[model samples]
Target: MPETRSYTLDIESLDLDGQGIAHHDGKVVFVDGALTGERVVARVTRRKPSYDKAQAETILRASAQRTTPPCPHFGVCGGCAMQHLDVAAQMAVKQRALEDALAHLGKVRPDQILPAMQGPAWGYRHRARLSVRLVPKKGGVLVGFRERRSSYVADIRECRVLPPHVSALLLPLRGLVGGLSRPDRIPQIEVAVGDQATALCLRHLEPLTDADLRRLRDFGEQHRVVWWLQPKGPETAHPLDPAQVDALAYALPAYGLRMHYRPADFTQVNPFINQALIARALTLLAVRPEDRVADLFCGLGNFSLPLATQARRVVGIEGSETLVARAREDAARQGLADRTEFTKLNLFEVDAEWLRGLGYFDRMLIDPPREGAFAVAQALAALAPAERPRRVVYVSCNPATLARDAGYLHHVGGWVLKAAGAVNMFPHTAHVESIAVFEPSATAA
Candidate 1:
């Protein structure tokens, strides 16, 4: 049987995932619902040879940073982890986590840390995937985030992270799904909100009856939300009522750019931080009218189009042919086609020869996924001196990978780690979004 004993621990610090770190009986204990510098009585829920996991049974002493979570389902819902921590404190912790990842994993440091990018702490998540389950035993269908550290669906009435209008649909959604003919077959719902409209893409494992479709349309009309249905995969999603809503899009007024994306496409969850990040990246790159810039892993020309506004020419390379086509269309519509060119290429396998084929660029911007851009960095490092970009800006969703790539660029590629900082794109969550600037070393230049 698992250990069921309770122990008192003095919380020392927080781990990368916001779990409180404590030492108990010569072993490391990770206690949930505990804050740093607090004394808590915790019960061991799970044990391992290296570390143990526990739940705080009682808080003997609380930290000043602790606050009553505005969401009643904070502890039970897996959507957020650090809601109990003060908003400013949450940003500070994320910044520290980024610095720690860079130091320990990458063996490098930035010359300066930029200010943390922050926005409204609540009602900021423009996109989310909510789980749906039919629990007839307890009540009816449950629609929300999963239970913390468990596979079960959380019983939540509302979600504060979603926009006010979207949050108001939670209970209504539960009722709508519960009354469906195949309530148990509906597995999940994808929520995407744009400045103009809100959409719900329902993922159903079974075919919906005519009656079910009518009910879904009714719910959409009642709640002023567009209904999309996915019979199997993301590609199968389409509008239930074709004439109801326009294509989803967001605007970056600073750059005079509008980005239209499909519901399943990967876009930033927080529009506020996304705009800030783009502005900061462009400023760091220092693009000039005479400069030729390259945007690697550029999805739908998010950065390429904006760069075109200032650069002599901008070349965007991405892996998805569909996204490349969309980007090309968007650039033309925005009257930027003359200065912008997009190509489809898998960047993960990019090498020195591939880099040279792209020709010389004065500046470059890389916004890679969680795996980071190690291959891109290595290729850039191997480029001929005359062909290498003078400056590069990297946007990352994972700090560990960012740090590793930064170390390679700074140490092996002879690049200077000029500045780096964290972006609070996901408030109350452990996910860290950061950006960094790099320049060629004096000798290399």
Candidate 2:
């Protein structure tokens, strides 16, 4: 139990949740956006005997790491939190955040901490889902991210993290939506990037008129972007017409491979970071010429195709039958079908015995959803020492779940945490994309 009373406190540390944790009068205090080495007076927002939350309204002295934010809607827009902090400082804090989480929650630490991975701070986000609103009381349509911790959309015109073209389209999108018959009915706008062009998917609640269709088509031609309209479910999305303009695709230069994906599919938003992450994960996996590798939750064969170049065979498992068939087609197109295998399985609820009957492999790499591949990881951990893969490379988007799963493998599976590090996959934001390597204890030393 903690002391219950109103007391002014100073922030000591920043948690991974983007909140600063400190102590006052023997009670834990969490202050929003208050960094270390800075003194601030905050009011208690919530009180539990053990811990309390506070809101910092003023900063008497700001940290040197803090800087002027470019976006006017910095605090109001929920898209990013650390934009005010210097880039290097932000990465350092994130590194500490991961370290703290592991030490405090997992009761363990990796033997080695890999250098944190950093990338372009601005114009790095290649993917985003923007929200739309028509607030009659306020004005016309609101075309941007939702307000910080609120359902109301932020009244924004430019985003520093988005690519220039995407940023430039916001104001125009607002005007265009204002022109729509039911602008408020339009809920989402999904953006995806392919190798050659950018694509936008408009999710509307009602059918569009011929006039509305003409405007969207005209906008597509003028901006040189592909326009897709989603009237119902995800499967219902399609191009405005027969000719697909500005098809988004990305290239993997190391393998001379080019792959195409729809905007809604899972692809790394930062090309540079994605490539670097793939290279790092492969190095950790250490694929051998004769080694067979398993890539669980592999989407569109991003890691599978790259693994084929080094491994004797690469097996990719995904939950979507559509994605599985598409991966198979991609493997065939690349003429790597002989080296790559595709399967559809619910990674979250896997059949351990059924997977064991399939044979074995030397290495495994997984890039699962935000859920963190709990079942798949647990099953892999349960395999006999002789049957289990020797090494694993995990790329994760959520820190808490990744740490939780990491604990299970290290504590229960007789494995050693070799190395864990952070990647600036989503800069200026609270999202931390990280990769970790685990190895058999005997080989770890």
> Top model by lDDT, which number?
1
**Highest TM-score against the true fold, candidate:** 1
RMSD of candidates 1 onward, in order: 1.5, 2.9
- The per-residue C-alpha lDDT of model 1 at residue 38 equals 91
Q: Candidate 2 — which residues are off by over 4 angstroms?
A: 1-8, 43-53, 443-445
All candidates' TM-scores? 0.97, 0.93
Q: Write the per-residue lDDT of candidate 2 for residues 111-169, one digit (tens) a residue.
A: 99999998799998899999998888877888889997889899998999899899999
Q: For candidate 1, lDDT tens digit of each residue in 266-364?
A: 778999888888899999999999999999989998889889999999999998887898799889989999999999998999898988887889999
| Whole-model alpha-carbon lDDT for candidate 1 | 0.90
